[model samples]
Target: MRILVILRQVYEQKSIQWSYEDRKLIYQRNSYNKSDLHALQWTREYKLKADALVDVLILKKEEEASEENKLANFGIQRCFRIPSNGSEKEDAAFISDLLKNESYSLILSGYETEDEHSCALLPLLSYELGIGVLTAVYQLEGKPNGQLTALRKEERGSLQEFTIQLPAAVSVTSHISKLRYHRGRSAPDFTMIEVKRQLSKPEAVRRIEAPEPNIWYADTPSEEIPQLRLLNIMGFASQSNNSNNLQKQTDHLSKAHLYFTAERLVKWLKE
Candidate 1:
């Protein structure tokens, strides 16, 4: 059984980083970067060091796509490029083509790209390709009949297990494992991979520039708190019955009286 690990080549050096001190986001060009760390983590956990046949699908922007070819030491089969269309759909379509021919039994990709408008594309791709998809996968176990069981990490420190047939897609989360390093500097090898460059020339409908950021400060007057609302009387029916079972009526005051007076007695009688 063959496996294809789809990975994105990001600027391992300069990328965005969240900052709690500034209460805003910041970009880190150097120092401990995430993409490289993430890639290395997958390499170690997946055991893709030596005899692993894998392919990396990277999308590069213009002015860098052609020149952005660098060897990732981990066993990567091939690296395909998509034109810098600047749209999520374009990127998805590019990935879809790479996955079209039913090339590999299992495909592993990161949960989200490094782009600002980041979206988990595994669901859409799986729907498009008619393949099973699992997200936040931490542990992958080989099973009989070319099937694999995925141990996924859910919210609140919970984990869920699922079994998927071969030829399925998975969106891997960063927290799944730790990144590893490759000692040698030989160029990565690729397998029998195929990708179509221009699926369709999409015309640009419109382009709008983002507005500049503006920091503003305001001052407001402090006022005393208002007194709590006081009910004239705790109506018997309103207090007894739940809000949902309490029906609304057109005759408002009469309805209230009927509800409080007769309904209350009827409720006790029914009980």
Candidate 2:
């Protein structure tokens, strides 16, 4: 069996900051998405158990030398890099087109991107390829009959097990498996294939920039506003606040309380 694992580099969320003046997000550093790492772990396990040939496809805005060294630490022998257009739909279409000529029996990817928190790529690619896609997959087992069994997470902390045929795609969650690092591994030298097909340019449209909202500060203590209190607990408040007490209070709040607080905040914002 042959498998292809799709990986994407994303900016570290903790290192990102909102540029209020620029009205955009400023990125600091790039890191491998944790869920993609789990998908890679699953690929490694499948290769070991089924003796399958595995290759990785990396989608990024630009190729970097550090990617080769990082993959080497995971003992990946073969990898391919493709330039991403940064649009989820365009990337999906590009990958679907690229996979059409390939002989890969299975495709794997992370459930969602950490930076965008979007889970639309795999499904869109599968739709374009006319193949089935399984989302939130956590466990996979190969069968002797050439089919695969997969366990997926469902609502209310439930797991559903089912079988799927080859030539399908699956988006795995971070809870699937832990990535095992191979230290001191030599990097594999592979030829980089450049994709020549260009996405057709859409007609340019005029864009309008909206005025930035004024920054607001509250005179009331954070404890009086549930939303501000939640933000304080999440380390989004002013640094001068008592973080130790906030952490203690955060630890004491139940999950239900957090959920309700977030829901209320969303409603308040909409209002």
Best by lDDT: 2
TM-score per candidate: 0.57, 0.69
Clashing pairs in 2: none
Off by over 4 Å in 2: 21-23, 63-66, 73-77, 189-191, 196-271
lDDT of 1: 0.56
Expressed as tens digits, the lDDT of each residue in 1-271 for candidate 1 is 4555554534433365556576554673322224433643564445533334556555544444332223455555566655444465666666776667657766666766654435455567677777888876777666646677788887566789898987888776666566654555544454433344654555657543343578665333232322211221322233344563455555656766877868779988777
Residues 173-209, model 2: lDDT tens digits: 9877887776775655454455564644434454434
Which residue ranges in model 1 land beyond 4 Å of their true spot? 10-52, 65-71, 191-196, 199-271
Which residue window of length 10 is worst by lDDT in model 2? 201-210
| lDDT scores of the candidates, listed in order | 0.56, 0.77
Tell me the lDDT of model 1 at 131: 80
Give the distance in Å from residue 11's predicted Cα in candidate 2 to where it truly belongs. 1.1
